[model samples]
Target: MKFTTAIATAILASAAMAAPERGLASRVKARAAAARGSRPLEAAQKPADTTNKTNVQYSSNWSGAVLENPPSASATYTAVTGTFTVPEPTGSGSGSSSASAWVGIDGDTYSDAILQTGVDFTVTDGEASFDAWYEWLPDYAYDFSGIDIAAGDEIVAIVESYSSSSGIAIIENKSNGQKVSKKLSAPDSSSHLGGINAEWIVEDFEENGSLVDLVDFGTVTFTGAEAKAANGESVGVSGATVIDIAQGSQVVTDVTIDGDSEVTVRYV
Candidate 1:
């Protein structure tokens, strides 16, 4: 009698296990069916290692957080459509190059500022030109833009050094920021502004505008930095701004930036 009872108990346990298995099969099938008609599994993908071992690329809609090292305190930046300033310095200046998003200048390398300075600008309407100068050029020529610009739009330009009689505009971003700076091949008689006083005059906010017209006129002489380079403090006696009456009547009245802004500085 005990042996029979033990066998019955074992059978009852097996049956219970089989019943759950059948229920689990049903649940699994339901889950499979739901998966086919419902949320698909997203396979995780690793970002492709695109750190440009050979060439750096420029981004029109660049966004990220970064820290810059070197003679850094404050920084100055401007775009032609209007100006936006930031407060980070990577000790950049003139006499270097920019390719893609980096600028090599003044014996220093730099990335773009994080744009914390809160500097803003405005335009009066119609046509406008983009321009600014850092002590050095960008790692490539993808440096400044002007007046009125939209995100994700591209503007290609050259860095020029002008002293009136002799000038040169280095084609900084014409070939993907890989080649050495080249002389702008735009013929002098061909109505293209090239060489040191390189100008890109964007026309027809009244109609068609091209990257060729984003221009910065006149050379930046020197102002704020020389004082800091000597005194170690940002003391100022105010600065001057030159606006084109043709560029829609100058909606912005004052321009300000932190440090390492304004192309060159002259001690008055």
Candidate 2:
């Protein structure tokens, strides 16, 4: 009798397990049928890498942010403007150390030539000086006359490319409201300005043929940066590239972009 009762209980338990399995199978089938009538799910895809896609190749002579047009665009960038503080050179080097901040058209990825204007800061034997200058590179920069610039002056630099070979550069001392504008004519050359890109750069400028010593300029923030295309459209800093000047692993200076128009460069 005991053996018969145990067998019956075991059969009932097995039946209970089979009943839930059957119910679960039915529910799963119902869900599958409903899903089949709905839209098919898409497979997951990985996000794209923006860091590698939107980047500027770094050079030892430059540390700044540069904005370029789309690859297909034959854009003729017309104007670029920004404001920056003259950074004081404080590096522990024996010789003179210098840094320059400027806004200009071309000379990034699309053109080897640059038409730029800004202020240069230099420190030699613990003395610091500031001078306003303009350059159409492959040529020496020319200094503006009759304007006195000192360190800590807030400056507005504007470069307007009016045509393929003509432009104007303006440098203003925001604190004193003193400013100067000069009409520029690019010297005869094969490398005409393509006007493909615009930049806010802090550069280790070259004298003769060598990179000048970079100054410890703390940080120079460029605000209110504006660039316009030939179509009168407001060009922005999207898809722009940030670069840091490095000597092997030792980064000398770095740059950052804020929002779509502001850039800041720092001596690291």
CA-lDDT, candidates in order: 0.21, 0.71
Q: TM-score of each candidate?
A: 0.20, 0.76
Candidate 2 wrongly placed segments (more than 4 Å)? 1-56, 70-74
Q: Estimate, for each residue in 1-268, the C-alpha lDDT of model 1 and write its tens digit.
A: 3568889999999988865322223323522343111000111222243222221112111111111121233321111111122111111232211111111111111222111101111111222212222212211122222222222222233232221122233222222332223222222332221110111111111001111121221122222222121113332212312111121222111122223333221111
Which candidate tops TM-score? 2
Give the alpha carbon lDDT tens digit for every residue of 77-97 in model 2: 889999987766675544567
Give candidate 1's TM-score.
0.20
TM-score of 2: 0.76
Note the clash tally of each candidate.
Answer: 36, 0
Native-referenced Cα lDDT, model 1: 0.21
Model 2 lDDT at residue 68: 64
